[model samples]
Target: MGMNAASVLNHIINGEPTTPCSSKGATSSQAKALTTTIINHLRLGRLGKAVSVLFSAPVPFPFALYVHLFRICASKKAIVEVRKVESHLVSFAPTPPVFLLNRAIEAYGKCGCLVDARELFDEMPQRDGGSWNAMVTAYSQNGYAGKALGVFSDMHKSGIFAAEVTFASVLASCASILALWLSRQVHALVFKYGFGGNVILGSSLVDVYGKCRRMGDARRMFDEIERPNAVTWNVIIRRYLEMGNGKESVFLFFKMISLNVRPLTFTVSNALVACSSFRGFREVIQIHGLIIKISYEEDEVVSCSLIDVYAKCGDLVCARTIFDLLSPKNLIHWTSMVSGYTLSGKTRLARELFDRMPERSIVSWNAMLAGYAHSSQWDEAMELIILICNDMRNTDRVTVSLILNVSAGLSDLELGKQVHGYMYRHGFYSDLSVANALLDMYGKCGNLRKARAWFYEMRHFRDMVSWNALLSSYARHRMSEEALVIFWEMQQEATPSKFTFATLLAVCANIFAREQGKQIHGFLIRNGYDLDIVIRGALVDMYSKCRCLDYALNVFIGTSVKDVVLWNSLMLGCYYNKQSEAILKLFELMKEDGVKPDSTTFQAVLLACISQGCVKLGGQYFNSLSQDYFIIPQVEHYESMIKLYGLHGFFDELEDFVEKMPFQPTAPMLARVFDSSKEYNNTRLGKWAVRHLSFLKD
Candidate 1:
């Protein structure tokens, strides 16, 4: 038909026929012809002309035409046209058929007009399985998972048999809310209805079970499917990856290949991720070869996974090569490479790439920020925060969490407070991670009061990290009683982690509470936590500080895996117990056991030497700090050296050492020298020490 004929047909379809002939007794042929013409117009993107035709149709238009019109409107989310269609349907036929009314409901729901959709659903004179399913699917798809489940319950109570689509929708709703109990109930219904072994339904069940962290059930569902598709295998493999069983995921992928189920982009992407978890170059190279064999190496997602795996496996050269070879590097490719560089501790390279990014996303910005935070480059992290704020880039929980860690590391309470204010203003304070990070930041910055306030303010939102953060702060600052009280409170509220015990043990060591330390140690042994390295280290330190040298020795000897830190802890304990000779013996034994001495090791040995008045041994260990062990001398190390020299009355050596020290002398170091000089009755050196000490204090 021509444009004129099309316009007249639209007028007639909309129920505003311009001619009596158009309104009178339209034949089936004429109705079909008009429907085809209107559909053709709709297909050509002439939505306005198509709607005009529908609205201008004769009264009581074909039910099929209304259905088609609703479908088109729903796809386009043309709420206005949908409303017009509904009004026309109502006015022309006061009571439409159930199918027609269901179509209207579906249109409204699809357009996000749930209120109107629900109203129409309630106003329906009669309901069927399709009508109920429409409402359920609508609520589920729009994030009203709870309401979807409620409607499904209502549908069940009303005695309507749900179809396969209905079951899929319900399973999806269960998955959305992570309602494991509800999903199990649905699984029972699916089997009862003989939809068991239905591959599609089985896959949906596998997905929900996987999401609920019930991997055993997900595996059971997968095995029951006689001929599972690639999608089903993908879900199970991805599930294994999620559960951190990457080896199993890779095995499954190989099994799928043996079955000749061709892998898709997601399948390859997930397998590469599984390989990445192994952190072995051999595994990543094998997966990279497979990507090449399958010709998915160029696929953006698969390539990004390769880059990440290579970087994680400590092969940055390969990762960069893959990134450079990408045909048209999108934001994801750029961000992945930046993250790879950051992960490998190449922050300068990461920043160069970040600056070269033509289009930066929040993810890219976060990658750079996280790199700086991970490397403890606090100043650079703050500078990035300023750039982000100036550029008005959106910040998410990861960004805020990274910044809070930076603030904590730098002990910048002022900067932390400003970030907290930003969080409060931007509605990010309610997020659990951000809230926990704030608590940690305040605690690390020495604001225990503010940390406690934030903790109590979290109320029911508190997680294990929240409790541990506050408790660790108390332990770190040596508030023994407060730390114990908080530990008891935490025990009452939540189960403690090994870190909790370690912190509590530190508190005991600080206060020299041997009895309390024994109690905590007993609890550790009783709870089967004695083997943990951190708890073991803490136990050694605590017993040594509390003067229970026998207990500390037993614990240290009992540890199967003795790293340098553990040896240092035990040596420090001996020093505290005045067993200077034993410190020297343990140091020799530690070296014999192949546990190389660290900075703490040297510090402990030097203290032991000072205690025993072994001047030559002290000087030998102090000089060997950098030469033998390659351990740089920190301020504390230098202080120990000064104490060693001054205690022995080696006035000339002590003076030369003070003058040639790497760093400028602090007040504490000069005060120690002054005290030592006075004790030895060296008036000239003592006077010089006093002058330097005065200058430092000023």
Candidate 2:
């Protein structure tokens, strides 16, 4: 068996030649014996020796032998062996068959060597449907959807008609690039080829529509599959899960069960993930119970999803119970448990558990690091980041993205630049999410130059998030001209989301651009983005800050449901416009609407009280701050009361209020009081303020 094949494996490792690839004058029976020996070695998992024996053999292998080796290597994804076998067949095997060339193409594709696969396909003097399908599958499997479609086009023009497998492979390519238009074209071809009744082909059509997010078309095709098997059921179920319709996905899962289709490991895991997506605690429990009854809980993937769902639903006790029960734990189990604790905000326990793990992946590290970010423990996060940067074996795009976000949260621009350097070094800069995170970090840290550079670099592949990220950067720094210009450019390519309008509204408010704000408002109505509360509130805020209190009030009145933030915005608008009476009236209307007032709501109310010199009314509201509303008075609340008292010359109330403050008066409070006393020619209160100020300075 050449058990010591690893010893001579240096023949391939160091680019040395093996024995002759041919044994001249060898009999067919002898060749068959050698082929059986090599296959026996391959079946025993002695791939090194099998390859060693393959290239070392005296006899050239049969075409069938080459097929076997290539098939096995394709399954094992042994690229080195694949190249070795490919070279041998091309050099020694005179007049290789197209089917063998097709096998070689399939092998290279499975090895993620699409370049070699395509090159081999191109060199084939003749091809059948298999050759073109193999090339299309090679490209599609390796994430080259455009290339796959290109080969399919050539296949069509070459007069080699598409088989059912060709359409299935082409649909997969369509799904990958989300090419809905091309997918529709392919769907017409599927029927033109008269494979419409094929269940698996129909499922592939469903996949193309599903991934394109045209779920209505997906469902239409899905229902056309009259006798849907497990694969078909899984396709629809998984697509719904991907689309984040957890309830629908779970319903399909139950429907599959009712139809007596026993879900496999993949089906159970997908169903569990669906349950977790919407935090369906009751569904999760039912699924968990079902899995336990079927002994499917013992499956590692199902167990991992169970832990994740339970942790996400805030049942850490149940999650830990599952985690502790697993035997011979692997990295997935450990990472899942750590992520559970992190998601639950128990970073300390997460860290302790993480330290105890025998091995760690970038995912576990990311989960722990994200906990620090969530808790705002930037210092601890930076220290963990140092450890991560040192041990970067598993560092991926996720790692780069997480570290960039942490740097942003810390507001450490230097650290962010270092991470940017690391990303460039590690080839993560091209990852869209990582690049967007880098852009966001630079923007948040007030480094416009770096953000703009990344924005330009990302333009070709940029999505809505990338455009919004750059827009947010401009808005944050009040680069009004740049924001407006970039938004106009964004509209030509990416559509603005609700949050995009929110950020734009902030830009409008910051620059007091009333006309621009009006346009955005009209755009919202025209585009049907007016329903979002946050966007509507942004519209109110934009008009309010532009001194158009009337427009702000109209938006506030038009919104069917008003949150406290919206009420505060309108009230603050009145206060800014010197319509102090209107602010008080809005507060009463807010109460009548039964919207609970938060701290900011009262701040606006108190500012209005100060404006009108409503001494008695202000006093009653100030008392009601804690008595009736139970809103604990903050320092700003106390300062507002002092200003109200001192402004109207209520000296007794002012003195008593200052004395009754629970904490020492802030400097602003004292400064305002002393200034008011001086203006009113009150020597006693002025003297009292000066004494307190001196003592506070001491």
Candidate 3:
């Protein structure tokens, strides 16, 4: 053979050899040749043959051979070969060198055998900085941040001067735990060691500060960087966006662009998120143009952000166009499209897309369930909830919250109780949103006692929504005194939202409590809530119902933006106040304001005509309901029509209207006809009304 041990080791280290193998069962010379062959095999990446040749060797190999094998095994993270080499090293000598021990420690740590690594580290008689660094890096890499920090402290106390790598690893551990003070101490050490100018170190510092919500400090550190890379800018922008300063983030993005810095996919994604915050349609479009300019339109994350922003802006057409054009629709993109459709009130399209999805995530299912709940499709929502509970192994809190909302909408107390039980069994009863939804469900279903019990039981979990839910329950039931008491209690516990005030005003309106309503109005004016459209509508209705037409008119005229609902509210108030002429005049003014009349508007105007006994005017408005505004008459509209005919003693017309009514004549309709007959002393009409009433009861 041409190879000696030195040359063979050199060849193994170089991953190549010049010699061929000899036969097995050989002399010492032949064993040497075979050992060269095994090294050569190992060098060629044939691990199995090398191990086989090593085990089948006639005698134990030289110490150099085992050392080289150990080095190779450690590098490859071959734990079995490492252990085998360790066994050979142990039998060959009483003690292994520090270098071999360090390699073994590192190999074990890299292979996630931390216990073995720690054992070897502790068994060593002496160690170097490399030993400590490997352990620290291992602990940090494996999510033991606090342990890594403790090890670093021990290394410092052991008189090992920390290197740049050591400081870097420690800084990473500190950042992971959000140890702001410790990170600051590390920063001081970095400058003391003159590594403060290092770009990687600076980036880590910025990240730590950003995560700790010290944006000002993060910005200052970022400015100190000589040439911040794309990642640096991305970090600062993301930090700003996370801190809810979208405008600042967008401005910084433009500044980065002005400096000719290339934007990455994350940069564009973050910028799109910033655009979504302000609903700046112009900025969103401009950023989209930039995305197209940079050829990131095809990127999945960027595309998803664009879809999300468009959906939030209520531009479902654009959102759908983007979604349709995506080639390979991922789960996230599919979920976004479903959510967009649901938000736009296109439940049918959402359901179709949901059914067609190749795979469904919990989020996708939750989106569809929430859509049904929001649209008041309680049956469909309940069906999907049952399917999810049975088919899916786990469900999140959002799913439970949505189902609870459906139960509330349907006022199905039994179903709500069942869901409550399911939540208790599934460990979701502690979720505040679920609790609030349960309270709302019970309240809406007329179980205020249960609602009150649940509310009081939520000692710490009660948030603003919980208080408002209970308050709205009282308001809805016209428990005026109880609502006022809850209102005051809520004011002491949590700040009342506009919704709370709106509910309270509704309670006042129902009970015709003028003093309480005026006090609330005063509070509204003092608190600058007088201009909220909901509060304004509630006030107009309350005052008009209280027979204070002048006060209601002032509030109505003071309203700058009079939607059809507000006009209808005022007109209805006038009807209730017996100002029938004012109702017609308000209708003319509404037409002048170009506010399209809804069914409520038509109902209010028709009610006014009935109050004044103006049959012709009421009939004209009823005709216009379909002809002028194209609003199909609802049940309320038909009821008003019957009342108009009955009040005017149009017995022939009233009977004809009853026969031609689109729906079966309800009890109120028969009562109206009967009362009209008694007023006019018409016994025949009364008998006809009596027959219809009897038929309806049967």
- Each candidate's number of clashing pairs is 12, 1, 0
Best by lDDT: 1
lDDT of 1 at 495: 86
Report the lDDT tens digits of candidate 3 across residue range 1-698.
33565575764444322222223435446556667788778757876677667766545455556656766666677877766666655554456667667667767766677787788788878888888987887787777899889998899888887777878788889878899999888889789879878888888788889888999899999999998888889989999999999999999998998898999899988998898898878888888888889888889999999998898788888888988998888999999899888877788999999989999999999999988988888888888888888878988888888887888888889989998998889998899988998889999999999999999989677999999899888878878789899988888789778888888888888888999999988887788764688888888988989889899999989989988878988998988877888988989999999888899998888888888898888988998988987888898988898899888888888887788877888888888889999999989988988998999888
lDDT of 2 by residue, 106-135 (tens): 999999998899788878888899999999
TM-score of each: 0.85, 0.79, 0.72
The CA lDDT of each predicted structure is 0.87, 0.86, 0.83
lDDT of 1 at 1: 56
| Ten-residue stretch with the least lDDT total in model 3 | 15-24
Q: Rank the candidates by TM-score, best first.
A: 1, 2, 3
Clashing pairs in 3: none
Candidate 2 local lDDT, residue 207: 86
For candidate 2, what is the TM-score?
A: 0.79
- Please report the candidate that would top TM-score against the real structure: 1
Q: Please tell me which model should have the higher lDDT, number 1 or number 2.
A: 1
- TM-score-wise, the better of 1 and 3 is 1
Candidate 3 wrongly placed segments (more than 4 Å): 1-228, 236-261, 273-298, 314-318, 487-495, 512-597, 612-630, 648-661, 677-691
